[model samples]
Target chain A: MIILEYLTVIFLLIGGFFLLVGSIGLFRLPDFYMRLHAPTKASTLGIGSILVASIIFYSFKGDGVSIKEFLITLFMFLTAPITAHMLSKAALHVRQPPRPDTLNIDQLENIRDRK
Target chain B: MLENTVLAVSAAIGVSLLLNLWRFMKGPHMLDRILALDTMYINAIALIVLLGIYMGSPLYYEGALLIAMLGFVSTSAVCKFILRGDIIE
Candidate 1:
């Protein structure tokens, strides 16, 4: 019984580690596109792990195996990238200027042809 | 052991949220700010789940679900507005 609790805690600790890594990546990444990779990947994994741990703990406690936790994980996985894609597309459509060194071939050629 | 782990995980999540808050405040671009907000929602949902586990109750799960669903809707709406300068038209 105590061992089971210890295992659950270990899972939670791992999840927290992933969350920390995700935030660090979000802070340190260079551009919007690069930064997009961080929170979606790291944070989603972190949250999913913790949710899985919760499910396990509850199941062990005879709580009848809640499936809502899995639903949340599925929802987050499905939505996070789609949201990022929508935001990136919107950024592009609005002509939010790319990073100064951005080597956008079409944009560069268009500018060159214009002048 | 379990109590210590819970405390540690909560502290770590709290620190991560603080880091996200810094991004939200300091972001140079609109999308960066939006991304920060989006990430904050994810963190909040995780915290809610953690809270449920800590308190040994299932009630917080409903709150987490609402946060997840509403967070997605609000984010998509903002992204749409950013693109079109109008949300529904």
Candidate 2:
């Protein structure tokens, strides 16, 4: 196996592991805020590494360094946080209840009522 | 070696996508469903990337990119409509 192949394999493994974790978090999290943040948190690292692996593998394919992966990576970085924020805002607007057992949400209404 | 790894990784991601689907169907709140859909598309991108690697072709990248763009836009539009009762200002 060539060095590039090894690198690609390693990165693909990492990306897959994180993507699984993210979805698991989304499935298991009790609240909207938690679930919204879960995938974005893991996806940046997960998809980012997957894209990186693509870049490395394709560049070695003699396509003269395919840059499409970089564009996807940039898009993820630029929009992930915005997506998270927007989702959270929608959750708040719709009043998706947060976890009651954990955290001191004593000021939850105060926070939600500001806008 | 790379083929085996890709196969394994793709299986793992497929499982993850299933989990996302479950959440989408069963989520308690509207936002939870949206979040699941968002997560699902992101997972799809990973799957597409793995497919490209396994197939040793760069053709799938365009699909991956298109999905990413469309996913974000749709997600944002839904969230905005829910928040303000309309998408466009």
**Judged by DockQ, which candidate is best?**
2
Q: After superposition, how far is residue B73 of candidate 1 from its true place, in Å?
A: 0.5
lDDT of each: 0.84, 0.88
Off by over 4 Å in 1: A97-115
- Tens-place lDDT per residue, model 2, B31-55, is 8888889988999998998899889
What value does the lDDT take at residue A21 in candidate 2? Answer: 92
Name the TM-score of chain A in model 2.
0.91
Taking chain B only, the TM-score of every model is 0.95, 0.97
**Cα deviation of A38 in candidate 2 (Å)?**
1.5
Which lDDT tens digits does candidate 1 get at residues A1-115?
A: 6777877887898899998888888888887777888998999899888888888778777768777789888998899888988877776765666557767735743543422
